[model samples]
Structure formats: structure tokens, C-alpha cells
Target: MGNNEYMQNAVTGWMVPHGEHSDIVMSTRIRLARNLRGFRFPIAFSDEQAEEIGKLVSDALLNGGKTGYAYTRMSDLKALGRQTLVEKHLISPQLADAVHYGAVLLSEDETVSIMVNEEDHLRIQCIYPGLQLENAYRKADETDNLLESRLPYAFDEEFGYLTSCPSNTGTGMRASVMVHLPALTMTKQINRIIPAVSRLGMVVRGSYGEGSEAPGNVYQVSNQLTLGKSEKEILAELANIVSRIIVHERKSRELLLGRSRLSLENRVFRALGTLSYARLLPSAEAARCLSDVRLGIDLGLIEDVDMNILNELMVFMQSGFLQNFEGGELTAEELDSSRAKLIRERLRQRAADGEPHPDEP
Candidate 1:
């Protein structure tokens, strides 16, 4: 798809947007990794073979399915554009660097995306806005089934599906939820729980997924093993764990309000104050401040600020997005200044409309 379409469509179609329990449950996602029957794994392929594989999947997606997906050649996108896609969670970091041989197929609404020739020959994923595990899984499964019918997928009667990673050999399904655990973080609970969750075969990774660090108290929790587990079992187990975490987060919020209401208010308002007046804010700092502000809004400590502003900030505040918004490349210093200006303007606009003022802090 064109950059215009990607820029417009991705933001609107983000899964698990801000909503009920969304303060804790940011989004739910299910990813299925599959390989074509005869193609060598991407690493094993010659450049010629990779090109052929790309065309093969691209053709199948564009012509074989009823789904109206827009296809974008990875080679056509600039590095910043590709990074923006990663920030949107519509593509993986590996896929961003796929360079000449990779491509992505995204549904018009951006709910479903298939990464061609990533870690696996194809990574088909579906996303839901909130804590909808079953819904995300169902959509992902449906998309996978349709693709399997149209293309030959490598399978083993003994192992299930083959993938580049041995751990993904069986169901090749990874179901995960992106949650905002600021309360858990603030209460010093997440540090204690992370290792415990790891022992349960659950993995907690940063917001950008595996190998990334959790920023702004946002965490992505998912099952660690896809092998030997049925899709239903996997989804069920993940849902149970996520639901419990949701409870813990909610309780943490309650505890904060009951025991440290003044402290909480000070922290949140300070964050808003920085965002309102800072002339230059780093992306990491912006993320931290935004998290506090978003938490304040969700907890009703601050009202009249729309959730959409926070959600949109998560995207446009990123470095690549800042450059995209300004329609050119930006030096690091310029990006910091621009990010601060954007946040200041948005918050001020809301305040001018008679919303809660951060000035009190």
C-alpha cells in the first residue's frame, strides 16, 4: 500500500484501543507462523529464491483470497516508513530490516496483517482492541485457514507446523496481550511477578515484543511454548493469566487511590506539567510522562482529556513518526523539540476547551 494509506489506515485500525479495563488491557494479539511447503527457510534461500518466494506469497494474497488486502513491497518503503510500521505493531522489527526480499499484506482496516518471509515464510496475525483473546484467536485462525487452503503449508503429522524456530514447531501460534501495568509498576508488584510468570511458561516482554524492553510501564505477556499445546488450550491459558493480571492491576489502582491519593495526584500532575511546559522532550521521557497522564485519565483523577489523544501520542511521538508528521528527516534535537511542541499543543487545545488544567500542578 502507499504511505498515505498506511499512515491513515494503521492508526484507525489499532487493536485494543483505550477502553474499559483498557487501562490495564491495552490490546490482545494472536500470531501464527507458517512456512510454505517447498521453499527453503528464508535464511537458506538465495537472493533469487527469496525474490521468488516473495512473489509467490504476494500473488496468493492479492488474488487467491476474498480479503481485500493491500500489498507493500518492503523494498519500496524508506527505513523511517518501515520503522513506523513496526511502531504500529503491524510489522515486526525483523521484517522492517527484511530489505529487498520481504513484503507485508495488510487488510484495509489494519486488523489483520501477513508478514511475508519474516522469521517464518509467513506470519499471520490478528489483533483486537481490548481484552478479547477469543476474538483475536478466532480471526487469526480464520485467516490462517484461508491461507492454508490457497497455498501449500509445510506440516508434519508428528510435529504440527514447521518454523524457523524449533519452539514454534507445533501450533506455531503465539497469543499475547499488551497491557499497561503502571499501577503494578508503581506498586513494585511487576518486578516480583515477572519471574513468577516466567516459571509458568508465560513470557513477559516489552511493548515492542520479544527482545525489547518494556517502556512506559507497558508490557506484552504471551505464552512461551507453542509446541504440544492445542490452539484452544493456548488461548485459554493465556486468557486466564491475563484476566488475573487485570485483576491485580485494578486492585493496585485501588490501593494507590486509597493509601496514596495525594501522592498519585502529585505524580500525575507533575507529568502533565512537564508535558505542558517542556520545550524539548525526549521520546523516552515523553512516553513516561504520557503513561502517567493516561493513567490519571483512566483513574478519573483527570477528566475531559480524550483517550484518543493518548493513543495517538503513542504513535506520533515516536522518532520516525515525528519525522513523518513533519514530512522530512529530523535531527535528534529537532525531533525532541517537535515532539514537545506537538504534545504541548494537543494538551493546550484540550484545556482551552475547558478541560482539566495541568496548571494547578
Candidate 2:
């Protein structure tokens, strides 16, 4: 599909529900930072150097026996298109903001993407639905190997992979998982979970990763130290920690259900009611309501509405996606109205399909 068509579609392969703990764990991602042996990092590189690096990486991936890979230059894309990519987690904001030399090589399913000249020479990334760190890492490793054979990566014998930042100098791997923790957040236990994870050499960032807000109760949990650790160690440690957090979140959900079923149900259905009928809904408010509705679905409080719809809504309600859908930049008020209309039509259509509600026999 072309870029426009790709953006218009609501679901990417990574957003589909699959793998372990799909309900709570949204996705697993593995990213490796590597720079070319003969080139400066992106920050210090001249425009000509940046262009050459982008070409080298793009050519390697496109011709590296990857049948479905397509390359696109960042400068060629409109602002809306670039922001839509950021919203979908397909590309980083840094790459999207590149003036002349940033580009991307993305597979057809979007499971694999390479960011050329962003924070490093290449940020090779692989993402999959739910908790599948090993699987994601395997794919990323394969891609890294493919490119390493064709390009000279900057490396030191004692330091492992050389990167722009000292923190990423060793293994140059960052493994992360995006998780839905509405129960923990609702119970006010997230404050405690963050510091605990930090103590274990992990971090809990917002959904978009570093310096982003966690709308819809979605958070990205990733390893902090890539130096002095092997890829296996980092992946295993992160997986174990995330598993523990999942247990805590599930228990918190049970606590909420046991202590205040009526109240929880009221909050969920009320959110759903507003989404189904509201004439205007701000983006942030839509996210909060959707989180409640998704929590309800996971807890068996709501059944007719599928989890996939909620996942799509999470992206569709974003400002960039809404504007792209409307075919123009929108005022805040216009965005709110369009977002509400989109949500209403989607939720109401699901309900109108004659699916049995939870109360039905």
C-alpha cells in the first residue's frame, strides 16, 4: 500500500491481538542503535553525509532479499503523514522532524522498520503484538545481521557496538513492551510501580516512549542500561519484570471488581454511553473514556464490543489521525467534534450488529 493508504487504514499488524497476555500487554518492541564506521553520528553530520548514510541503509534493506520492504524519505512526506506515522508508533518523532536526510525502510506488515539517520546511523526496529520479546528480538537480530553484512557498523572490541550516546555504546539494544494498566492506574498503584521498576534498571515511560504522555492508561516499559549487558540478558530481565507487573495489574483489577463492582460498571458504561452519543469529545477525554471501556471489556463487563475496535479507536482518536481523516488541519473544536463522531459511529455500529450484550441470556 502507498503511504496515504497505509495511514488511512485503522489497524497495523502490531496492533492486532495475539501472543502472550494480549489483553494487558499491547506490544513488544526491540530496537538496535548502530552507526556506520566511517561516518559521524546524526547530530554532528553534515547534510551531504546524512544523505549518503540514508542512501546506504535504505539500499541495503530494500535489496537485502526483503521482498516487501519500501523506502520513503522524510522530506517527501507531508507534515500530516509524518505525524500519523508517529501516532502509529511506526517512526520516531525525531526521524519525522528531519529536514533533508531522514528516511525509513518499512516492511509491508510494518513489523520491521529501519530509521535512517535518527540518533544513530540506523535504528533497526521490530515490533509485534502483545508480549513476545524473544520473537521481536529474533526478527531485529536477523535484520541487524542482514545490514551488518552489507554495511560497516562502528564497533569497538571492548565496547561492543559504538553509538552516538554512551548509554547505548555496548549492546545497543533497547527492548520494550507497551502495556495497558488501567487497573493499576485506577487503583493509584502506578506511582509505586514506576519507582520499583526503575530500581530494577527498567523505566516506565508514556505510550509514545520518552517524554510523552500516557493517554488511555497505556505505558511503555523498557530497559535502561544497554551497556555492559548482552542482548539475551536485557531481553530476559525485561520480560521477567513485565510479567511481574502484569500480575500486579491483574490483581488490582480483581480488587476493583471485588470491592466496587457497581461503581466500576457505572464508570465503564457511563464512558461508553458518552462515546456512543456525545456530539463532541476532546482527544485526551476520548482516551480516558476508551481506557475505561477497554478495562470493562477485559473484565467481562462488556462483551459485544471487540478489543480490536478499542485498539483502533486508541489510534483513530488521536489529533493527527483525526486531521488526516478529515483531509485538513483542524481547529481544536473541529477535532473534538470529528473525534466524537468517529467514536460514536464505530461503537454504535458494533452495537447495532445484533450482538448479544452482557445482560442477554
Candidate 3:
């Protein structure tokens, strides 16, 4: 398929909300980093070798899959398109900006993506809506197995998977979940809970994973240690921790409603007021505002809004996605104005549908 078509097609069915805890648990992701037996890491590869590596992984991914599987050469896409993929979490920023050859194999559902020639020969990842760790891991393991049958991965007698990063040396697996913790943030409990989670061999990363800020009260919790543990053990441990966090978040929400209903509603309504009336909204402000509205929906204070729309806005309202959606570059002021306009339109449409808004009662 063509580039624009590929980008649009990749988003199909992928961003829709799913799972029982989907209101709070945004998504689950499992990634396995792997390199081929003889090929050098992406950084060490020459021009021709990088091309060969990309071809090898791309071809193998397409070998037995249906049309849902797509291969896109990173170099072929425009810079904006690559950034859009990054916003969608389908590819990494490093892979998007790779100098040498790089490509990605994406599932039609947009849940599975393999970054070829990214730090490793392959960075295979599976994403599922809501708190579905086991489901995400199942798909990731299947894809890894299928690829392994066609290509021999670099492995050591002592380590399971030989990766460029020492931390990913064994198992080479990273399991994470994106969650909304507005209650914790609103109650100032996140500060205390974060260090405790760190002690449990877990990390609370920003919304888009490492090195990003927790915009919209969204955080990604993932395993820190990958060495020495079996893949099954790692998944089990991460799942247990995530479940506990989910419980905590739910309880916190209940507490807020029980003891501080008026205050919570006031904050949610004030956010809605700014979002619907603002003429210019910065990316960060929009994220934080949308986060409150999303929490309102989760708590049944807002009936017109849906989690699916909130999830889509989480990505589409980003600066890169906004520029790409408009099909051209925008000045900083223009982007802010456009983001506000978009938010107003979305919230207005939902309001016009006759559902109860947070400000109504």
C-alpha cells in the first residue's frame, strides 16, 4: 500500500477501547528485543548490511501472514508520517529517526509492530486495549516464535536473548501498562506510591513510556528487571503489580466521590469550561484538561463522553498528530488554536447528542 494509506490503515481497530478496566487501564504492551545470529546491531551495520537486515525481517514477517501485515520502509516515509507513527506508539522515536535502513511490520489491528533494524535486528511488540497483559504477551510470544522459526536469533548459553542493551540481555522482554491515575494525582498519593513501586522492581514512566512526562495523569508501569527471570515469570509478576495498582486507583476514585464529591465535580466542570471555550490551548494544557474530563466520564459524572474518544484524543491532539492531521506544518500559535478548536468541536458534538454533561447537574 501507499504511504498515506499505510498510516491510515495501521490505525484501524487498534485504538478502540477494550477490557473491563479500560476506563482506567488505557492499554497493555509487551515488547521483546532481539538480534539475528550473524548480523551486527543496527548501529554497527554498514549501509548495505542494514538494508539486508531490514529486508530479512520484513520478508519473514510477511511470509505467512494475511494482508493485515504490512511492511513500511522508514526512509521512504516523510518526516511527519514517521512522527505520527511515534505518536500512535506503533514505532519508537529512535527508530523513526534512524539514519540507516529501518522498516516496520505492522498488524492490521495496529496492535503488533516489529521495528526492523532498531537497536536490535527486531523490536517486536504487541499492544492491547486496557489491562490485558496476558493477551498482549500471548500475541508477542506467538509473533516471536513465528519469526524465530524463519531467522535464528543471537542467544547465549547463559542468557536467553542476546541484545545490545545489557539490561535486555536475558529474556529481552519489557511488559508495561498505560493507566490513568487522576485520583492518586488529585489526592497527592502518587508521590508516595511511586517510590514504593520502584522498590518492587517496577518503574512509573510517563504516558508515552520512558523519558516522557505524565501528561493527563497517565503513567506507564513496567518491569525494570529482565535478566534471570523466565518470560512467564516476568509477565506474571508485572500482572500482579498492575492488578494491585488498578485496585488502588479504583478505591481512590471511590474515596474521592464519597468524601469530596463537590470538589471533584468543580474541578471537572472547570476543566470542561476551559476546554469548550478556550481559543488557544497548548498541548500540555489540553492533555491535562482532557484528563479531567476523562476522569469525569469514568466516574459517571459525564455520560456523553466515551473512553474510546478520550483514548483517540490522547494521541490525535498531540502536536505532531495535529500537524499531520492537517496535512501540513503549522505555526505554534496556529497549532494551539487548532487544538482548541478540535477539542471544542468534539466536546460540542458529544454534548449535542443529548447526554448529561458534568456541568448539567
Candidate 4:
């Protein structure tokens, strides 16, 4: 790409924002989704002829892209008569109610986009507020938005903020694609092509990115270091990556389709809730869960739970219970100091039932 691309990306700072948070919060948010683009092959196959498109996407993502999610068209548990190929571990009990939104089974030549929510993300909205705020806000998303206001950088001592230069602050752009590049990473031709590839605006990192390592042997080329690059520069990089990704995607379209790609959307949330309540978890536990949360999103298994915020929030919410960490809460350990005693009380009759459950402490 040329400097014109970078120059075009340079724009004035005039973003209108939503939900007010300190700069620390604005800068600590993680990029949750990919700005998707797709390619269509010359030929299409009938639904009945498809056996493995979903697996194809899954393998490709697991091998090449940072994020991997699939759509399953297999029979549904509640359908008139069908059975899906997804494992029970891939399904979450909490989101069992929202399962419909969790998975999709697309036909041949179909495309899907991924989205994750940043709880209090601000978008520069135009034409909606008073003239002062009009057109000042960035678009609803990063690809089309502006970084109107940047907050100061801060860290969470308890949960530990994600540390890396050019951090993916507010509305960080998370671009993941389905690439069929098992050999591309090792090929000599590709080695020569990388410099040209990256100059267009991408970083060749592992599946997870800088914060975490790739789960398996997969390689990911995401865009995380663009603080100084202009919008056009970033877009050019994204477009270039999209172009290369299309080639790989097409190669795998035949072997992988009509299958599911995510594994832990609900479980991740449940884990979050569990971690939040399990005050016993130390800093390492919190850090591990943070990566787990990231895995859930990258694999298309989970939805919008900000790990950094969730981890810190867990400590804040449970600070009151740390005193009980010594042994037990006054309500239980103080009264009986024995598991048998607690269980026995729970099963006792009203007459034998004893002290109030709420005030036993």
C-alpha cells in the first residue's frame, strides 16, 4: 500500500461517545469479533451433497486463523427429525435457552459473520444528538468508526491488565478470518510474500495473538499493532489479509462446511459466574480464566464476556468474603466447623431444625 492509503486513514478526532467510563476502562477492553468478508466459488453444491464444510472451516480456523466458528445444518434436537454433530461439551447449560442464536447451519455458498459485545462500548453516532454531538461519534464499530477520544492507560493489580504495546483499547478492532493455509505458513513462496503481505497492515501472530499462545499449531495473522497507522492504512491491511484469506478459504470450502465451529459460549459464562463466586481463586486462577474466556470467543463457543473486567470485578465483588477465607463464613464454619453438621442441619426437621440459616454465624 502507498502513503496515500495511510494519509487517507488519518482523520480529525471528533467522536461522539456513549456510556461514560474512565480512560482505564476505555483502554482495557478486548477486541471480541472479526470484521468479515467472504468469497464465492464458481460452483455450488446441494445441501444433500455437503458432508464436511463445517469441519473444513473448523480445521482451517484451528490451523490458520485466530478465530474459528462453524454453522451446522445437521438435524436439530428439537427439529421434526434431525441430529446434529456437535459434542455436548460444546453446548453450555446457561445459554441452553439461547441455543437458537448460538449455532447456525448454512447451505453451500453461505457466509457468516461473528460479533461480540463490549458492555459499555461508545460509538460516535451522527445526526442523533444535539448539533454538538452530531456526526462527532465514530460509527457503531471500529472498521467504520473514529477514535475520537482516547483514555489514559491503567492496570488492574488484582486481575492484571493485558500488557502489550499498541494495546487494543476501546473498541479494539478484532479481525478473524477462516483461512485454509496449512502449508502457506511453511511454504517458501509464502515466506517471500509475507513482507508484502504485512506492509498492507497485518501481524503474523499465532492463533490467539500477543496475550496468549495458539492452542494447537494454528497460525493467525491479526491486526493488533495499529496505534500510529491511519484508518486507511489499517483498512488496506485488512483488505489485503481478506484477499489472501479468501484463497485459503476456498481451498477448504469443500472439506469443511455445514458444521458447528464454537464450543463454550455458555460454559464460559458459567465458568465466569463460578469464578466470580469462587473467591478462593488466586491471581493465577484469574489469569487462566482470562485465557479460557479468550479461547471461548476465538473458537466461537462464547459470546460477550470481557475477561479483564470480569476478573477484576470478581475480586471486587468478593472482597467482603476474603475474611471467611481463613476457614469459613460465620454462617457455617463458625457454627459447626464440620461438613456433616451443615448437611445434617439442611436435612433436619423443623422441630429439630435449630438456629436460623441466615444468622447462624
RMSD of each: 3.1, 3.3, 3.5, 25.4
Model 3 spans with C-alpha error above 4 angstroms: 1-14, 350-361
Please provide, for model 3 over 314-342, each residue's C-alpha lDDT reduced to its tens digit, 9 standing for 90 to 100. 78788787787677999999999889877
In candidate 1, what residue range of length 10 has the lowest lDDT sum?
352-361
Candidate 2 global TM-score: 0.95
Backbone clash numbers for all candidates listed: 4, 0, 0, 23
* Candidate 1, 124-158: lDDT as tens digits: 98877778888888889888877788788999999
Cα lDDT tens digits for candidate 4, 281-345: 44334434544443444344444433333212222222222222223344433322332222222
TM-score of 4: 0.25
How far off is residue 201 in model 1, in Å? 0.9
Off by over 4 Å in 4: 1-180, 185-196, 211-217, 228-233, 248-361
Worst 10 residues of 2 by lDDT: 352-361
Each prediction's Cα lDDT score? 0.84, 0.89, 0.84, 0.30
Instruction: Predict model 1's lDDT versus the native.
Output: 0.84
Provide the TM-score for each candidate, comma-separated.
0.93, 0.95, 0.93, 0.25
Candidate with top lDDT is 2
- lDDT string for model 2 (1-361, tens) is 6533644465788777799999999899999999999888888999999989888887787777778988999988999989988988999999999848899898888999999888998999999999999999999999999999999999899999999989988999999999999999988999999999999999999999999999999999999999899999999999999999999999999999999999999999999888877888988889999999999999999876767778778988888888888889999899999999888766754563465333311
